[model samples]
Target chain A: MTPPILELSGLTKSYTAGGAAVAHVVGGVSLKVGRGETYGLVGESGSGKSTIGRLSLRLVEADAGTIRFGGIDLRALSGRELKRLRRRMQIIFQDPFSSLDPRVRIGTALAEPIRLHRLRRGAEVDQRVEELLATVGLSPAHRHRYPHEFSGGPRQRIAIARALAVEPELIVCDEAVSALDVSIQAQILNLLEDLQRDLGVSYLFISHDLGVVRHMAARIGVLYAGRLVEEGPAETIFADPRHPYTRMLLAAAPRLFAGPGAAPRTEIAGAPPSPFDLPPGCAFASRCPFAEARCRTEAPGPDSYRDAGRRAACWRSAELPPQAAEESTARMSPAFRRRLDLLHTARREALA
Target chain B: MSETPPAQDADTSAPVLSIRDLTVRFGQAAPVLDGIDLDIGRGELLCVVGESGSGKSVTALAAMGLLPPAAQISATRMMLGDKAGDVDLAGLGERQLERLRGNRMAMVFQEPMTSLNPVMTIGRQIAEPLIRHHGLDAGEARTRALEMLRQVHVPAPEQRYAQYPHQLSGGLRQRVMIAMALVCRPALLIADEPTTALDVTIQSQILRLIDELRAELDTAVMFITHDLAVVSEIADRVAVIYAGRIVEEGRRAQIFEDPQHPYTLSLFASMPRLVAEDVSGGGRLAPIGGQVPAPGNMPAGCRFAPRCPFAVTRCMAEVPPLAAPAGSAGDGHRVACWRAPLEETLG
Candidate 1:
């Protein structure tokens, strides 16, 4: 698969805060993004999802392991080589408003990246800036507007445009649509999807929102306390998830719209444990309902689950009690239910 | 269908709180809440869903008579229970509103960290509401505060009562806020995004706690939120607000199943689906272009016309009256649109 456009092997990052000893935020996360494949890295807040994103881009130095992009070890690259490598990889931050300098206009923000990468100058730079703006669905006239003048959705579009200016092969979109409204999120998701199809750009999409991840990403990697607990195809993970944590996440996520008899979500009672003080065995063992004696003493390595392509780090992957398969229907607002039902009926007829 | 137990279906004649055409304005500028109307039936939770600057907070603030001095509020009709009659909240004096704020209507703000006093013990903060609103003695208030904390599912209530805001986590602080807001057993409670800052798990717990407490106290609730999912879970009726106006309002089922407004449809379409794909070919998510206009800079005709896909000349040139969309069960369903294609749009 083109040697995986971007690959990370046993990446680890830690921090020493407030005179305390070392705390490993990202213990050892290993995943790969194949050429033109969207790899979703899912985790909760403080789960090292953002840290891994930053580490991949070398925005934050990793304490251990390798980051390989396009057959080059990013960790081993030096000076000009590292900087040159960065031009091909970009990151779209969570908070769009704060990511771009408030003092700079949209056009200027787009221009800086192109200029820094030495991709274009003069007339070429202007044309590239306009192209980037239009690529993200923003009008060229919006170039003069400051960050504050734009809405959250437009600001995010601007950020995406800025990311695309350098024509990066791999873009790390970290919670890109988390702050946006649902309608705006759909627009951005569609934009990103369209861009990927057109540009053949690979993405390491990091987010806490699994539903969004499921829709946009082909392969999914579930992260917990800086460790990759599950990595598999999106369809496999969603339809028949093996990891207990993965199952819990899928259940907790809010469905778009469902009928009256839709199943109630299986809620995980407590929050994820602190990374600094994670338990010795499985990091998720504390919150996992099926935790056993074995789980408390030994962490499970990635093992084949439903297929060879799908792997989950769990002791009870194969022999767990069956989770009651709840009716997986969209939860419609009462007003939308009638419309949704009609639409469903029409769709069925058309399919027949 | 699995019906709720018989015990859960008790009916009452009087709504706990009723508001009509509640308008709050700062000077001559367009009303922040223009002709906003709402009702909270006894023991029912009504969630007001809207984006930022949709006047959700303004509506809550006005209900508590907490508007700034320069602000003007007016309502054709406003009532709290049968006894209070139709007292104009806009005209109510500072002294009367102050007495009613905690005693009859209490509010839980979004951020518990900033809302709770850092210097005071969590116990005292909760107790203060009881002591002032109900005129309870200090000792009794302290006892009641501990009870309230325990009721809100705060473990080791006694120890937590003495701890300051800094010592407790976000979830704990929110519990403390709930305890303080419900200390007086107000007839109506206004929770303004109480769980927005908490994690999803914690958010669910908080919602469950609110539901349980509301049932126990029989207090009507005005829940303000931006998350449609949360509203679907908790709201008995949903109000879709855009630009300080209720574009669509209906029962939870109607709101979800028969959304007529383009904005409402977009909200549902935008929601990330959590199911396996089927013959439906995945419902094409229609994102409404453009931003929600600023309060003062509202459009000439319909507020949502600019962003709506079905916007016609009439929609842009003149304001559309709030009318019932076709195929609605009854009059309760309302939408403000000039040319809402009720049949095609619903599909």
Candidate 2:
């Protein structure tokens, strides 16, 4: 098997609060993304998913962890070496509006990275910018326009183009398409997938929306209060979520289409505990329905489930039944089903 | 507490709020909301679903008489029903509307932090409506405010009542907003993307709370949102607005089961499916081709034609009126399109 493109071990980060106590934001998170593989990290706000993403790129330094890219320890590298390594890993933020400079022209923003990396020089830089724009489905003519001139979808395309300009092997997309409308979100997701397939770029896709992560990621990790509760193949995790928190998240997400007489969605009982005041045991113990006395007293480490590749941080994962697949069945009303089927068929025909 | 009769049972025939030929425009620009006709029955949750520039929020604001002074609002009939009777909200004076705003009708905005008064305690904010509208004393209003907070299921109602908006979490702040909006038990409630800013778990809980309150108090709700999944969960009826016009309006079941308008169908197709396999096989999401036209530069005919897959030359030349499709379930199901059923037209 080919080596993983990026790997981290025992990553931990904390910030001092007030004058004395420390707030653990990312605690002992370790994961890997293979070449051209998307590793999705999903959790509620303050789950430390974003912190982990930033830590991998050294945007936020880890208190204790070993981050390796292509078998080189990032922390051990000198400033010069790390600067060169940055060209291989870039990040696309959630808000395209704020991520790009308001005054900079779209072409200049795309060209700046190319020039910084010395990827191109002189007249070739403008040509490269136009090519990047076209790669992301924007016209070459759009290069002259400013960031504010484009809409949300186009602006996001520009951001993606800028990220691609550096030709990074790994791009950390933190809620990359969450701000756009649903239709526009689909376009951006498709563009990301196409870029990954064509350019062979791995993504550390971090988002709060599980549905989108499931669509874009090959492997998934469920984070709760700065800790990874589950990690496995996206298909396996969605099919048989062992951790109670994973199950609750899957159930909590609203389905695009529900059956004519589907049951009401189940919601997790309470908000996530603050990272500043985490419990001694499982971070999700307060809200876990199946939590036992031991769960509140002792934290559970990642344990292998039925599958060797699947791991969950729940003592009862071995005993828990597989999730009911009823949620996946296309359970639209007959009339609605017929209409959607027709629409899908028509769409496929048009695309073909 | 006075034994108030069930609000839903009072008038089954008359709608809680009704509007016809409603139009709104800013300064000299094109109209943002054009000829929007809507009706919300007592206790009914009518979700106005649309994209950002589709005028869903504008409709809600216009109905509440909350549009800015520079904006022009005109409607043939804009009636709002409450305990007193039906009042013409469109023609009412600012002073009269001020009396009706928080008394007969109330609104919950997308951001609770911005809507809430930062300096004021939650108790004072909630009690303001009860005291000013219902003529309750401050002490009595405070007691009722605490009860309202408890009803919204805010933990530690006593403590939360005295705390300011900044002290509460997003979910809790939204609950306070809900409690405040319902304190007066206004016949109408306009919630503009109330849960869009919240997480899924919190969003579902808030949705459940709103559903329960709607049933318990029988309040007519105008829920404006861009999410179809949310609309499916909460709406009894849905109106799909596109470029300042309602392209389709129908019962929730009817609309979801058999969406007639191309824009509605496109939205459903564009949404990422929960199941990975469903999304994986498709090469690209079947997104509508173009962006929604800006208000000032709207097309002469169908506003959605530029992005419509089934658009014809006729579609670009003439605007379609909202009418019942030929073989749809009932008059309640209406579509504004040159091509009513896409399957037939596209084929």
Candidate 3:
């Protein structure tokens, strides 16, 4: 197996608002992304998934822990070294509208990165910009157009092109497709997948939508209140989630279509606990249906299930049933199941 | 609960709201919404599903007579209540429309933060409608406002009453918005993406609250949303809108089980399913290529023809009327597509 292109360990970050600790936004998040692999980080708002993304690129400094790139410790790097390293690590933000300068032409935006990195010179810069545009499925002629001239989907393509300009090995996608329409979102997701294959670029994909993450990522990490509650292969995590919080998330997510005999969606009884005054225990304990006395008073460390290559941080992980298996099957319609089978066999044949 | 009528009987009764050939155009540009037709029965939840430029919100606004003065709205028949006792919303004066707006019908917008007034207390905001419509005194309205808050399941109603909109969480703010909209018990409620801004857990809670409230009040709901999953959950009837037109409308079961329109079929295909078996292949999503045409550059024929996978020469030359298929159950299932029942043509 190839070594991980990016690795973060024991990462912790906090913020103070009005001279008071608001919350530890990212509390001891650790994960690895191998070369050409997609590592998905899923959580709701304030789960610090975005902060993790920012911290990996050192766009936001962590209060503690280490970030390593290509087996080199990034935290110890000086200003010059960090700047040089940033070219190989890029971030694509959620809102494409605000990310790109409205006044700048698309060509200028793409060329600026290549020029700044000294990757191309003179006429070669324009040629490189056009190549980047074509790579993201946009026309070279669109280079002259302003950001406002393009729609949300194409604007996101432009953002991808800009990220690709620096020839980054590890790109962090922070809710990149959340703002797009479903049809448009599918287009972008397919584009990202195609690029991943052709370019062999690894991704740290962060989103609140588990379905999208499951589709894109090989490995998945479920975050709650700035902590990793579960981590496993995407299939194992989706099929048989161990943590109660992960199960609740899967049950709460609305299905694409209601089957003839689907069960009613499970409702999480209470709102998430405030990050500011989180109790000294499981952050999700208050909302967990199976929370016991131990769950309320003691925080559990990661418990590895060696055979499944899965881990869950819950006191009751051993006792918990595999809730996702039955629910996933019952939620899918027969027609969808048939089409999915056809798609799989067709894909496998093409790959072979 | 006994006072509430049966859902089946109510479905057979005259529609609570009916619209025919409703068109809206701003200035001389192409119509934002053209020849739109819909009928929502009493206590039915009709989901208007579409993407951004599909004019779902415009339909809601036109129904409420809340369109800007410059925008032109025309409808052959826009009636509220049954035919015998119908109220012509199109012909009503501004003064009369204002009276019916919040009393007989109410709207809940997508963002509760902006929809609610920041300075005013939540109780006062909720009580405004009760006092205006029911002729209740301030003291009576305040008491009733607390009851409304409780009905929407806002925790600690008394304490929340004094809090400003800024002080409440997103979920709490939305509950307050629901309380304000339903305080008067309107016969028709138009919710424009009420849970779009909320998290999944909060969104489900709000959806359940809306479903329960609609059942108890027996109020017809016109739910506008871009999320197909939300539509699957809350809608009794589904209307698939595309490029300012209702391409298909049918019962939830019919729409999901046997979709007719190409656009609707593509929408279903585009969504990433959450099942585990499907995730192994890492196949590409089925994307409908191209964008929703700008209002000014809309096609003369079928608006969806450009992006439709089943498009033929005729599909780009003429628009199809909304009609039932040749062989189907006599449910009011309708589709406006030249090549509908796509099984025959595409196969």
Candidate 4:
């Protein structure tokens, strides 16, 4: 059995505010992505989803915790070793316009990475650039075009092509398709899925859009105020969400159909609390309709649920109103639970 | 086939605003907008839906007499109707147009962060239109501003009125923009992608607020957006635009359930629904290949012909006139296609 491609143990990232005190943007968190597996990290703004993605690739230095790739501890890697590792772990940014250099042509942008990685050079580099461009559905003729010449969708394709230039094993896509139109977003998602299947690349896809995540991700982790509140298989999370925070997020998501003749929408009542001053207990306790006095005082620790492989940080998950828990929990029978537990235990032991 | 009511049926007496045979060209070049005709009845929310560079925004700007001097806008008739008597908005003098700008026809623009005056207090911003358009005193204007904020469902109107644009959230700022636009109770409101910058939950709130305001004020609305779902929610009727021309116009239900134009079908198919596995086979996406052609060099025939699966020699040779969809609800549903959908036979 192979070790997970990327693993984080008790990762914590804190930032010092203007005053005397330090603020923990991301509290102690732990998650991992295996080789060729897509892990989705979902959260609202300021949830530290983006920060965790950055921390994984060492884009932002984590305050404390261990991030290991294969057998190597990323934190312990020095200058040269770190440089080598960067080629294997790449990141796609949120804004294509800002991420890309305005002055450089698409070909030049794609070539720079290959040159940095020393993958190829001379005519070989030029030929590789054209091939990469064609791979992302852009014609080789578009290599000379600047960022402004292309629309949002094409610009994203160019970004993807640039990410693939070095042939990285893992790419952290941060809100990669959020800004594009709905139709265009589907195209980009499909492209990413196809690329993943063909290239066997792992992705730490970070976004607030759950629909996109559900379609592409096998496992999903819900983050809030830098802490991992819930982590489970995408279908189980969507079908029978045990965590109150996860339920709230699912409820808040705008649905397609709702009223008579109109589609139902997932409407959230209030906004998330500011990250600077988070509440004790659950980060979502303030907005939780079912919050009790105990909820405000004690933060629930992560616990395995109906499926031993599924984990959620919530006190009253089993106590969820009948209808809310009916569909998902009903599907999780004893036989399925035993199977998932056996599979996960084997995978964990192999990693250890 | 049954026909849904036209968007203009709400006001059978006359349209609040109407444009006929409108042609707009920049300099001596070919017309960017060619013979676009539309009507906005009193209290009707008619969304002009299109992608970027589709001239939906341009149409609204033209209605407001805001086109550049270089744009040669010539329409056989562009009328703004009310009980006072319809006026030719296209023919109005600059001073007359200025008077009508914020008084009778107000617009809530996209990107409220930039559209709003950064330095002005929310109260003062909302009061500006009341004072200037209604000739109210500053004290009275401020009072009216508070009322406007309340009307738009801004919580704690008094405190919010004193806050600046930068201090408000994206949703709140858009609401402030709405309050400013509606303070004078304009007969018509033009919102250009007003909620595009907001989150989904916030977008719905804004849409619901707009729906409520339109009902209360009996104000006509011309909403411009690319989100078809939003159009389905708020628009009584929708006009599908491409390359500066309206390719189709129909009642909301008719447009959604039985679209006539190939482009319209493609646009709906392209949108990713909230739930996966509902429509469009698993892993199969319905994205339109290729980019929108540069508006400056639009194609001679149907602008959508290049991407249309049903394109033919005739479609490439000449422009298709906007006509009633075959077997559709009378003139209520219109399409600009050489061939409409054969769904009845195929399905």
* Candidate with the greatest TM-score versus the true structure: 2
Question: A1-352 in candidate 1: lDDT tens per residue?
Answer: 3459998988999888777866789877778898887999998777789999999989999999999998899999887888988889989888987679999988998999899888997999999888888898878898998999987788898989988888989999999988887778878987988899899999999988777887888899998777888889987787778899888876665444432566665655776777668788888898898899989888787653556688889988887655644324533344345444444444345436
i-RMSD of all predictions? 5.3, 4.7, 4.8, 13.6
Tell me how each candidate scores on DockQ against the true complex.
Answer: 0.41, 0.45, 0.43, 0.18
Location of the lowest summed lDDT over 10 successive residues in candidate 3 chain A: A339-348
| C-alpha RMSD values across all candidates | 3.8, 2.9, 3.2, 7.9
**Pairwise TM-score winner, candidates 3 and 4:** 3
lDDT of 2 by residue, A1-352 (tens): 1368899888999999898778889888888898898999999888898899889999889999899998889999888999999999989888888779988888888999899989999999999998998999999989888998988899999999998998999999999988899889988998998889999999999999887888888899999888889999987888888999889888777665552566656655788988678898888888988889989999997653446588898878888877774355366556555555666665666668
Where does candidate 1 stray beyond 4 Å?
A1-3, A256-260, A265-267, A304-306, A321-327, A330-352, B1-9, B82-87, B274-284, B323-327, B338-341, B344-347
Where does the lowest 10-residue lDDT sum fall in candidate 1 chain A?
Answer: A326-335
Off by over 4 Å in 4: A1-3, A21-24, A251-267, A302-309, A322-352, B1-11, B83-85, B278-280, B344-347
For candidate 3, the per-residue lDDT at A49 reads 95
Clashes of 2: 0
Residue-level lDDT for A23 in candidate 4: 70
Arrange candidates, best TM-score first: 2, 3, 1, 4
Q: In candidate 2, residue B250 scores what lDDT?
A: 87
Worst 10 residues of 3 chain B by lDDT: B1-10
Chain A TM-score, cand. 1: 0.90
Clashing pairs in 4: A255-A265, A255-A266, A257-A263, A257-A264, A258-A263, A258-A264, B3-B329
Q: What's the candidate order when arranged by decreasing DockQ? A: 2, 3, 1, 4
